[model samples]
Target: MAITLSERAADHVARFIEKRGKGVGIRLGVKTSGCSGMAYKLEFADEAAPEDIIFECRGVKVLVDPKSLPYMDGTELDFVREGLNEGFKFKNPNVKDECGCGESFNV
Candidate 1:
């Protein structure tokens, strides 16, 4: 099982890490809150935890907690732009349903 980042997503993350001057990679996880029961969480990771699973994609590291692996396996993180709107998107194979606001999902 693994999680990955699109080239654009990786590029964006790399730029952020460079700008911040220090970081090991980005961490992806989920939290139990939101209309659909789960919401994606993203943050800069300064280091990997012992229980974290790391995947290298597009020359960037993507970190995931062991507990989140089953739900996030085979997921691809992407960065998208549509006119004035732009942000990270999740392409998750395990998602059965998503909330109207696109902030959460249920498998």
Candidate 2:
């Protein structure tokens, strides 16, 4: 079981951390809300919890809590640009469906 970030995603995150001036890495998690029952949650981590699972990719750290591991295992995160919009995209092997608005997913 593993979660990783694409090189572009890692670079993007690293730049954000540098600009913010304080962060150890980025935390990725899931929350129960949204039309499809689950939505992705992201935040800059200043410190890590004892139970957090950390994966190092492309010279950056991607942190995940133990509870989210099963749902996010084998996920590869990417940062993409489409026309004028750009954001982090999740390539999750466990996702069975996503909401029409693309805000949430169900496995």
Candidate 3:
């Protein structure tokens, strides 16, 4: 099980961490919300928890809690800019269905 960051995403995250001056990496997880039952959560990790499952992608660490691993396995994160708006996108293989608005998913 692994979560990878595209080159653009890795560079984006690395820039943020550099600006913040304290983050060791980024954390990825799932939460029980949104219309489709689950949603993605992200945060800057100052340090890795002992039990976290870590994957290295493009020189950045992508940290995942063991519980969130199943849902996020084989997911690739990408950073994109579409005209005026830009943000992180999740390409998750485990997603069976997603809300029409693209905010949530169910396995």
Stretches of candidate 3 off by over 4 Å are: none
Q: CA lDDT, every prediction?
A: 0.93, 0.93, 0.95
lDDT of candidate 2 over 1-107, digit per residue (tens): 88999999999999999999999899999999899999999989998899999998988888999988899999999999999999999999999999999999999
Candidate 1 clash pair list: none
Evaluate model 3: give its lDDT. 0.95
Q: Tell me the deviation in Å of residue 48 in model 3.
A: 0.8
lDDT-superior candidate, 1 or 3: 3
Kindly report which residue stretches of model 2 are placed more than 4 angstroms away from their true locations once superposed.
Answer: none
Q: What does candidate 1's lDDT look like per residue over 1-107, in tens digits?
A: 98989889999999999999999999999989899999989999999999888899988989999888888999999999999999999999999999999999999
- By TM-score, the candidates rank as 3, 1, 2
Residues 1-107 of candidate 3: C-alpha lDDT, one tens digit per residue: 78999999999999999999998899999999999999999999999999999899999999999999999999999999999999999999999999999999999
Cα-based TM-score, every candidate: 0.97, 0.96, 0.97
Which regions of candidate 1 are displaced past 4 Å?
none
